[model samples]
Target: MGIEQKAGNMGVVTLKLEEVINWSRTNAMWPMLFGLACCAIEMMSAQASNFDMSRFGMELMRPSPRQSDLMIVAGRVSRKMGPVLRWLYDQMPEPKWVIAMGDCASCGGVFNNYAIVQGVDEVVPVDVYVAGCPPRPEALIHGIVTLYEKVKEEKMKDWA
Candidate 1:
């Protein structure tokens, strides 16, 4: 792995910078555990023995935000929780991505009260919105896959 070289000009595969970065990022997405409500159960199910999310490189659901770049907001974010969410989002290092899992997090679901924030997007910028009261493990996986597609197309020029 010292240097990438063509095998006797058999065929050289070319990959865009974005593709390479996105591939690495998606393959090793370490999503932090930021579940706030019922969706937490479904989030847990995605990581349980049945789903085995390890194959997608999300087996370690870290509790500390400082150690993670991917955050799965898997529940309703109340008004009181908004500040906490922002604080944690700030704590995370750069190149961070957020997934608003479930309707509650994406749009406050059936909650139309003042206590609810209406959406986690008000608290943090969302990279993906997983629709449902609590999206099934497959749904979450699909959401992640969608994110991966986005990541793969991200332009490095934006960072510069």
Candidate 2:
């Protein structure tokens, strides 16, 4: 007998399977159009026909945060931009995700001098931290896929 049969329920197993499928489908994200520095150019390159981020279902770069589910903090986070970043993050709907796309965004890079926010995480919750002085397009794509996997594994109802 299968695990479902041993548990005395075929219907419950079917429902669970459906839930998993739906979660995976919905979590295929669309990232917002926001990039601050050198990393922004790399991000653009990733979306271009060359690298093609569309394969992962994340090519739709929404102009508005409300329409996007993922925010890729691609460069340095200055103190002045910190509030703006937080506001943008807040604007995004529930089940949203954030990616710190480079050393600058992840930990302020070489700019430990004044005026920088130190790390994008200080302003918004980061789901994935992609390390590199400026990570390559491949690394960015890998981070997006990693985020998708995390979203798929999330227990929706339990998440508050």
Which sections of candidate 2 miss by over 4 Å? Answer: 1-27
TM-score of each: 0.89, 0.85
lDDT of each: 0.88, 0.87
Kindly list the per-residue Cα lDDT of model 2 for residues 76-128, writing each as its tens digit. Answer: 98888999999999999976889999998998889998999888888999999
Q: Highest lDDT: give the candidate number.
A: 1
Cα deviation of 157, candidate 1, in Å: 0.8
How big is the positional error of residue 3 in model 2, measured in Å on the Cα after superposition?
31
Minimal lDDT window, size 10, model 1: 1-10
lDDT of 1 by residue, 1-160 (tens): 3244543444666988777887888898888977788989998999999988898888888899988979999888888889999999999988999999999899989998999999889889999999988899889989988998888788899877
